[model samples]
Target: MAVYTEPTDEELATLLNAWGLDGLRNFKGIAEGIQNSNFLIEVRQGRFILTIYEKSVVLDDLPFYLGLTETAANAGLPAARPIRTQDGEMVQMIRGKPTSLCTFLDGVSSQHPPSSQTRAAGAALAQLHLALADYPQKRPNDLGPHNWSELWAGRAAHSEDLEPGIAPSIDQDLKEFAANWPRDLPRGIIHADLFPDNVLFLGDRVNGLIDFYFACEDFLAYDLAVMLNAWCFEANGREFDLVKGRALIMGYETVRPLSQSERNALPLLARGAALRFFLTRLVDWVTPMDGALVRKKDPRDYAARLAFHRNARSAADYGAPE
Candidate 1:
C-alpha cells in the first residue's frame, strides 16, 4: 500500500537485468516505512529490498546515507549493505525517482520488544556508532533543534486543535531548548532514528539496522536520548518503563560507555528528541500530501513524552546508573 509509484513488471525486470539479476520471481510493497516506497524483492540471486526515494529525500544526500550504511555493514555490523549494479553504481533511476536495492535481511521488527531485545538493540546501535566513527562523510542533522521553530512556525492553531492548550507547552519547550541545549558532548555520526521498527531482531540479537535516512553528525548522546525516548516508553507514552531503560543503557555501555557530561545532558537531550518527532508528526497531520501513502502519525504521542521529559531531573530518573 506504500507503493506510491508502482513500476511495471517489464520495468522491474529491466532494472534487475542492469544489475545482472534476472528471473524476478516476486516483488511486493512493504508497508512498514513512511519516508520511502519499499518493496520486498525476490530474484534468482537472493531476496532484496528496492527503495524508491520519495520527495522528502534529498537526492544529493543519498550518497552519504548509503555510504554510511556501507561503512557499518563492512565493519561487521548487522546493517543491510547497498547492492551495486554491474556498472558499480549503487543507485538507479526508476520512474524518474532515485532507487537503490539492498540485500534483504532476515528478521522481524517487534511492535513491543521486550527488555532483552531492547538491550540488544541498544548495544547494536553503539556498535554502529563505533563502526562509523572514522567514516569521513558529514551531513548535518536537518531535523535537529535548530529547525524546530521553523517546523512549528504558524502551526500553533493546528497543534491546539489536536490537543487543546498544548501549543503553549510546545512554545515553552522550544524556548527552553534554545537557551539550555547542550553545547559540549561527545560528537559523532549517529543513527538519529533508531525506533524499534528500524531495528530487525532475531531472539534478542540484532539482525539488521535498516533505514539510515536520518543519520547525521551530532552529539552521540543525543542518539542515545532518541532511543531512550523511543524504546523505554510504554504504548500510551505516559508511563516510562524503568526496567527497559536500565537494560538499554546497560547494553549500550557494555559496548561504548557514555561520558558523565553525556549522562548529565540526557534529560534535555531526550526532551529535544521528543519535540523533534512531535513537530514532524504535527506537520504531517496538518499537511497531508497527495498520493503519498503514509499514515500520518499523531503528535500527541510525543506530547506525552515531552511532558515526562520536562519533569525528569537527571539520568538517574531514566534508570541510568549513578
Candidate 2:
C-alpha cells in the first residue's frame, strides 16, 4: 500500500505553485506500493504518479534511479518519465521526504505470466540492461553477492531470533554453497528487485518496469537470475513454464548474449539472488517495522527457490535455456 501523507488540497495547490506546476489541480492517494507513498495528481492538463519516497529509498540516489528511467525511455524501453518541476528538476521535497511525479503507467502485473508476455518482459529487461550500459553512476547494492554472505553469516548466528530455525544443518548448507558456487561472471547494472508488483502488464505484454529503488551496479546476469527466481517459480514450490523462462533469456540474449563465464555463473548468482530475498524476508518476519502502508512481502515465499538453487549446478537446473 502506497501511503499518502495527508496534504490538504490547498497545501498541494501551494506546493504546485512552489514547484512552478501551478494552474495545478486535484490529487488523490494511490494505495499500491509498500516502499513509497503515491498520489495520482490530476492537473488541468495531465496525470502523473506522485511518489513520496519513503524511508526505503535513499533520497541521494533518487537521480540515479530516475535518470535510469530517462535512459530506458531513450532506449525505446517502456517506463515512466519524470516530470520536471518549475525549478527544472525531476525531484523535489515535500515534508522532508523526497517527492516527485512520474507519468502514470497503465496496466496490471501478470502473476501467471503468459509466454508472449514473458518474452516481452524478457526483451524489456534486456533492453534495460543494454540501455544501462556505460552509465556512470553507482549506488549501494543492498542485495549484492557479498552482502548475501554477510547477512547469512550475521543472521545465521542469531537463528534463535530468526523464526525459521537453523534447520539443523543450515550453516553446513551455507558453507557448502559458498564453497561450490561458481563466480567471476558478467557484471553490470541489475534490477535487484523485480517481483510481480514492480512490473506492469497489458494482456500479455509488459507495459513498463517500475521501482528502480533497488537498482545497482552488479552482474547483468544477476538481474536475469533474479527474474528466474521471480517469474519461473510457482506458488506450490514448483518450477513450471520453462518456455516463459526461455522467453526471458532469449529476449535478453537477443540484445546481449551471456558469455560462457556468465552462463557458468548463473546458478550461483541465482542462489545469491534467492538468499538475498530470503534474508530480507527473514529480517522482516523477525522484526516487523511500523507505519508503512505497504504490506511486507513474505520471507518464506522464496524458500523453495533457494532450495532449488541449492541443488543447482548449471543453467540446466533452471531449465534448458531456449
Best by TM-score: 1
- lDDT by residue (tens digit), candidate 2, 1-322: 6464766667677667755564556678877777787888877657778888878787889999998887777777778888877778888787788888787778898767776776777777777888888777887677665566666665664454443554444565567666865556566787778766688998877787998878998778888888888887776444645677677778777777888777788777777777778777777766656755436666566666777777777776665473
lDDT of each: 0.90, 0.74
Regions of model 1 farther than 4 Å from truth: 291-293
Model 2, residue 282: C-alpha shift (Å): 0.4
Residue 102 error for model 1, in Å?
Answer: 0.3
Model 1, span 1-322: residue lDDT tens: 4667788878888889888887778889988566688999998899999998988788899999999988998999988889999999989998779999988998889999999998999899889889999989999998999999999999999988988988999899999999999998888999999999999988888999998989999999899999998999998689999999999999999999999888999999999999999999998888857756556777898989999999999999999988
Q: Which residue pairs in model 2 clash with each other? A: 1-294, 2-32, 187-219, 188-218
Model 2 stretches astray by more than 4 angstroms: 2-4, 18-26, 157-170, 176-183, 291-294
lDDT of model 1, residue 107: 88
TM per model?
A: 0.95, 0.89
Worst 10 residues of 1 by lDDT: 288-297
Among residues 3 or more apart in sequence or in different chains, the pairs in candidate 1 whose N, CA or C atoms overlap within 3 Å are: none
Cα RMSD (angstroms) for every candidate in the order listed: 1.6, 2.7
